[model samples]
Target: MRVSLCVLLPFVFFAQTAQYTKDIEVVKVGVIFFNNELELVRAFDTAIRDINELELDVRLEPLKHFVSEDDSLTLQEFACELIDNGVAAIFGPSAKASSDIVEVICNTTGIPHLQFDWHEENFYIHTRNHKLTVNVAPAENMLATAFLDILHMKQLDWKSFTIVYENSRSLGRMELIFGWRQVHKAGIKLWHFNRGDDYRILWKLVSSTREKNVVLDCPADIITEVLNASIYYNMTGQFNQWFLTSLDTHTSTIRSLNSRQFIAKMVAVRVRAYMPPPVHDEADVF
Candidate 1:
């Protein structure tokens, strides 16, 4: 099912308006997304249309700015421009550096910053007083705890496993699992792979070790490629189990991969319900 953005609009609007004058009839919301995030942009636009169809009392005007993922200066400029245009809240530019820049801008201006992507830092722990930022994704510690709970419930805690992560941010999601391993003295192996790196080498090493349990964490976009590598290495059989930590594991591409034989042993955990994008009918769409 496609998830409507209307469900979130009321809370955001009410929260933002509470801090300002309630006499306003129209609210301007700023959205900053990278040029590559067309799916996110489409989803946001769909949500806005859905909200408008409701004919609510307060009209929402979206001020969207598309910037290069790596352009920090442009991101800052657009964010400032949105603020100057009187946007009540800003969302997106999920890249870590860009998000940080927009977050600081929002914090300084007392504007709400809403994020829907995974982030390594926990503001509640690191910046206790930063109240202007809101993250829709699950916190890293909470996600780790859920992973631990799944391990226990599935009776996989006693078994040795390998953690295959794509980057430092993905590794950070496993921090609590690492602590659990230390306390329990469990056999856990760590393997890191860069985005474009060959996964055969990592899978070869894992296969040689005879590891049956695997925890895979990476950006959603490359997950299917990573799993296809595992399949090539004969790691998706009945004896092997895979756990995915990406919330977007349910995307159509991954779902198609999972439909093939021998992938039933794979499992995924997500805090938020999977909402198919409005353009899900299109192949490989996220």
Candidate 2:
């Protein structure tokens, strides 16, 4: 009886510990940024601190590794480990492709994910909708609208548009639907739309673009393809600079971008205020 009580006592202690730990709905955060660069790392960390204020139970655990072409598998593995460790929610990896991987893991694990700006098909569902994914930032549709607004504001009356996209994931297709709506919003028209590799089609559209402009939503590696094509056709100056979406600002890609090679363009980006926890009310749990 004495040995039985001793063994039973440890089991009881373990149960109490697990139950206590599970009571809180941890708003777990996961991010994929250029971890080696202090600027990107610090900025990302500070953003999470602000998020902690919104929910008393929220916590952030940065996936230490960054995402690059070579490191994607590593990052994916680390993220799964985080999910296994009982993360209740996820955030960051703001681009569509990377976020899709996270979305799949969260769905499989029965955890909720909140991708910030980029929304993939069936991944983002609003909190009000009672779905697993949420997006706090503007959607790609909103991003396309912003670019169209820029054209209208500048009163660039080119009637034709060219869309460059990738379908490695479904994000490009989703954006195409929204981009057309943006064109309609500007009272303009869309021309040749191209998707996934093979930039030959774009040269054919340059004559049309000689009168208008084009929109490019290619990923980092593929952005160079459009840049080369625009230069090849000597249509670089024919239209407004190609527009892109904000994605992982990795070092190698930044170094690869030469202003002389491709005309400078603006991407859909956000200026977020990164604040730490409230020191003023540190004593109050509420």
Candidate 3:
């Protein structure tokens, strides 16, 4: 139920190395976002307020530029605008594809890119300049370790499991899990549940496979639907087990999950952890 994520030295260095004049100092940062997440918006505003209250030598001016999630040209144009306006760092645009585009633009402009999402495996194969990419989220390797630890704790063989994911971002985890199997000399099947697919059909397919152990990596909003479908199909029992890899699972209703007709066997893992700031301090880390 508990998870931890640490922001390593590289990010600290970026924050610490902010330049300032003796009389006046300021750091401009840009955020690229496409989703309309009220909580995320609140957090960003909260961060600015906290930073101001700290009365540090340097001040941070954060600007958010929203764009269509799938518009590559718009992403590039907005990124260029941020660079042109003298942003020291850029954060977000959580989608993998958009983040990748923003990353390339940041790298070209030598701006530190802060990301909280997954990166494709192929992107890391090169040894080029990654000095500008600062990921606040846990590293992919850490996720792999956590996942493997879960499987090991459950004493389940890799071959006995199947991975079901929502989109491309989830593919990163799938690939890591697939790679981990090489170490164990085992392999597992992979399935994708697209946005509009019928959950009933998906449940039937899953049931037909007779695969008891399933690792589901999907958005929090879809978890309830998946569970409900499973319940309808009588897929909840000792014979079936589900491992959810979504952080927001903790926020789900416990009573609904513990319905009278079915005994749900589920365990979820969150990849991010928040640490409290020092006593009497309002500063926070993300």
The prediction achieving the highest lDDT against the true structure is 1
Q: 1-286, model 2: which lDDT tens digit per residue?
A: 1111122222333344445776644434455554444554565556545444543432444454466644567667866877766654555454524435666666667766655444554433433332555555555566555555644444434445545445434344344445444554553334443446457666656545452355555545556555566565655552355545434323115445465645534333223333456743222221
Candidate with more favorable, higher lDDT: 1 or 3: 1
- Candidate 1, residues 103-171, lDDT tens digits: the string is 778888899887776666765643843467777666777887777777775434446788888776676
Instruction: Quantify all predictions' global Cα lDDT against the true fold.
Output: 0.72, 0.48, 0.65
lDDT of 3 by residue, 31-101 (tens): 77776655556656666666566656767687888776678898888888988998878877664454467
lDDT of 3 at 229: 76
> By the TM-score metric, which is better: model 1 or model 3?
1
Among the numbered candidates, top TM-score falls to 1
User: Which ranges of candidate 1 are over 4 A from the true structure?
Assistant: 1-12, 15-23, 122-129, 155-158, 182-186, 258-264, 273-286
For lDDT, candidate 2 versus 3, the one ahead is 3
Which 10-residue window in model 1 sums to the lowest lDDT? 1-10
Model 2 C-alpha lDDT versus the unseen true structure = 0.48
